[model samples]
Target: MTAMRHYWLATAAKTGAVLADLPGLSVPKVKKVIGRYEPATASFPLVGKGVPVDWERILIEGATVFHLLRDNPNDPAHGIPVWGGMLVRPPRTEADDVQLSLQTAEWYFDGRYVGDKKYTGVGQNLIVKDLVESFAAAGPNGGLPIRVEIVNGGDGKPRDREYQNSDDKTLYSVLQELMGVIDGPEWTIGWEWQANPERITPVLYVGDRIGTAKPAWMPSPAAVFEMPGSVLSFTDDRSYGRGKGANVVMAKSSGQGGARPESTPMVAVDDLRPTFEYRFTPSTSIKDVGTLDEHAQAKLQILKDGSPTLEMVALADRGPLLDVDWFIGDDIGYSIGKSSRSRRQPAAIQVDPEGYAPASPVDGEGYGSMAGLTLDTDNYAEPAPDTRPIVPAYPRGREGVARVIGWELEPQGTPTVTPILYAPE
Candidate 1:
């Protein structure tokens, strides 16, 4: 059965009361939605051309919220809420259509700053929660319809940390600066929908990782994507650009009178190659000593491996079909058949359980055939030298366990998803 896309225009309040269940005619003209976990954000375009004239008022910037859900044909009322956020910009009217832009809930923190805020010693999550709460509890004009929640205490990291920044900096920027410190926590503004009670809550999750560590909730078998079947195509990128990609990062921050303070450099030799070092500098807004260390540690975590990223075009929807449903931060395994050519034909098939989904044959020899192929063949028949390309190494061993950093879904026809992946620590 094919899935349906649903859009809702609701009041931008904590209750999130639905103001309108948009009809097909009033829905956005475009169906593409993109979501990211880090710097948690989403983007989609909405047009007023086809929308009902009366609904135009609700499209007013900063007045209403937007939600996109993928509904199963069997249960339309209760659907998988994919992306929910506020309008990022004002409407743009061209010819006859008014174009509107929407972003995820995290955009609320984009302009919010932690001006003149000083802290001697405080937990990072607590500091973040306190800042977010100030916005949540603000006047109606300045408040956001969200609540902060810590899923994991950053793997029980120290709480007595210092953060004192006088320069005007967005709350999101502060979080980024702090999280960039090695071993710091990551946060996201995600949606939670309860069918029976009919409640949708915007939750801010901060911790070691999104769904891992203490108070764990999201748990399932690791998602698997293989070529010749699920994966349509993929690109593996490995970079060693100076400063951009490095195994060693020296955290630096500005001191009084523009003086720069330096911290112990953090190193993680992920690449077997010679040491690649880069000096990490936090924004001038960050003035604390400990915060500088955090930024360096975090920068090292990403630069440590030369910032390896994988982009895969998957031939599947993100629904529950074939148990392929996945969230933003889920650990997934994707393997390209071309990369496993050097391994014995059967060993490659065993590596991916779905079957022998070979990308191409070597010397007109197909790996899918089981006829006259046996374990003994690998032992006795291999007197000839194998010239196949060796399988390239992935982040987590040969199976290539990776985290889903972000994804884009095109649900209009022949639903497809393009997933952005990165190596996880």
Candidate 2:
């Protein structure tokens, strides 16, 4: 059934004055809502150096996977804080409510590497090629290559020793630990076709390869408010609960670069839970020096460029602006039937497993599209040299459909239309 309801599942600094009406932000009574039961998710990562706020719980309660975007739309001396993530169409709920359980568009693989299961040699960054390979085994469209744009994101560095993880983690969660040094201090990651496996043309914001925009099938939003109720519903699924934050944790290197090459895997650190201590390094000399708060590291990753600090995390940009496409473009017909999808129109009938009991037209979407054949199939299918087009006339009515009543054709001659009838819809 077509969904008549919508919502945005988002999170923010609970103490912030900006996103006051938060948690379950309601979708305006606008017509341009996303089609189907799709989940919309937003998040604020808790990163960088500072006093730790218990944000690990937030990571679990919110979107399962997220893209850490550095947005300063209003690039002022003080930067605006913005973090973006991914969402998919949720399955039908048992009740009338919607579920916003968001999984990252990127998938992860877990296995034994060096030590126990926790020290699963898997690092923050999994090869895109390998990821698509493993994911394709699940389904047909699942293997399709989705263009994942990792703009301005820092490389995931492997530390000097073997590490252990309580659980596997997503690459996004891993890179969110370090601030961007390549495109720094801000950039955005936008992707499509996660729900619909069809490939979406990529957009080039600045490069010479900039092409025209793609036709967006989903309804665009009108306005985005910072009021509450954005995160309207939550799932009680404990599997993806606090313990299900990131899938893989990066294990330490078996040996250092030179002199102190260890014979066995070096145990760098222990498992990270809702709260874990860390020691980050650009180089040994530039290490965090003391124990670091995992939450604080996330807060710093999202802090404005030069304004990256723990205190600023509380006042960071609290939104995605939540606006839809600026304007809807005209429809450009796409191929169906014989050309695209490599399938032909069926000559057989289709029946719904559930008996056809259509709701009122007001409720809409009561039937699937139907196709029919003419009585004189040869004239329409493979017209003879003298075949001509014909139009049947009947009493004018507000609504009616023409149906074949009979056909006229000799055993050796071309078929022709004989009688036609019109009936009200």
Candidate 3:
């Protein structure tokens, strides 16, 4: 049979399999000699001493163009038995080549539409649709082989060059035709228009792990409004002494303040307030397949068992503010606190004079009213002369002051360490 005939037969067989919800017979397996058949070695062993056998779950769901036919037992042809098989072709890759084939097919058919309008026609819409669908079906990491070749136009080589030069024009015409029949915005087509070649690389996949790729196909919002809910607010309030007949009055102001009266006793005040909140929709429908890290290979093992699951958390920032929320959780509020320099106390020392005697010749002793110490006035002055003159000063005792600058609390049983800053002295 001719190649065309064989192709049609294969297409029909595939269609029949789809309609019957059955797996196509494995041609490779059937071609092998039954007695000589040997199972391939497993790259990794499943159990100690045996090779692992892998089986793919047959996909019985797809578009089918044919239905099963029942044969009459009384007919001689029916009694002889009828067998059917489908011809399976490898997937197509190479966007440019696939696009060229589609264009050539349209030109050869004289504008006859073969596939879905949303898929085929102008702008290589059909070709792109096919490529996307194939890519998706093959898994994110799978690659498709696409081909592009120059085709002869009846006008000759020069005509082919013209076609190449005006490829966008041909695409535009096809888009117009498709748009006339379909409902949507006009399809846009261009090359290297806004794409960054360095980052335009395709997503890689090894087994089930899909490599990183920017989702450029996603649609952008018509207009992005800054939502009020996205903003986080914080307030600080402190009051000292009772309201009625209180001798002390405390007033706190932020930003700008008015002049104070001369008779009014005043005290400096400082306060700090900071706010943080996450603003994200809560839903499981949105899946965020995180970037592949060092554990990508190990994670693939889980996907082979079943469909991979994922959760996405939306995050946004405006100026100094940030908002984040989980897509699959109830609305909740969270708080974060910050320290201010003015709120912290300065370093101080506590001294005592309980052992000092006024009549003693000791000179470093002094007596005065202080928070924690009294100085002895009788011995406040330096000694006139010491029986043993002080030995040559050894590097004039270096004076230093050490104070607590910061502190942090690590949650009980946690390995993490956190720092708490202190106001500078």
Alpha-carbon RMSD, candidate 1: 8.5
Model 1 CA lDDT for position 269: 45
lDDT of 2 by residue, 1-425 (tens): 22111212223211111111122322211111110111333323223433125433334442223222222345322222212223333334354333434433222211111111221333222222123233322334332233333222222332222223432433233222222222112111223222232222211111111111223453322222111212111111112222222222212212256532112211222122233222223212112221122323332332211120100001011222221211111111111111222222222233344333222122221221222211222322333445332211101101111222111111111111111111111
* Runs with alpha carbons beyond 4 Å of true place in candidate 1: 4-15, 23-50, 72-75, 92-94, 115-121, 140-142, 154-156, 161-166, 194-200, 212-221, 255-258, 267-275, 318-324, 338-398
Give the alpha-carbon lDDT of every model.
Answer: 0.55, 0.23, 0.20
Each model's backbone clash number:
6, 31, 24
Q: Estimate each model's TM-score.
A: 0.72, 0.23, 0.13
RMSD per candidate (Å) reads 8.5, 27.8, 32.2
Least accurate stretch of 10 residues (summed lDDT) in model 2? 308-317
Worst 10 residues of 3 by lDDT: 1-10
User: What tens-digit string does per-residue lDDT give for candidate 3 at 93-175?
Assistant: 54311110011111211212222222212333334233333432233343222122111111111100012222222332332
Candidate 1 per-residue C-alpha lDDT over 83-113 given as tens digits, one digit per residue, 9 for 90 to 100: 5657655545444444456666666676666
**lDDT score at residue 92, model 3, on the 0-100 scale:** 33
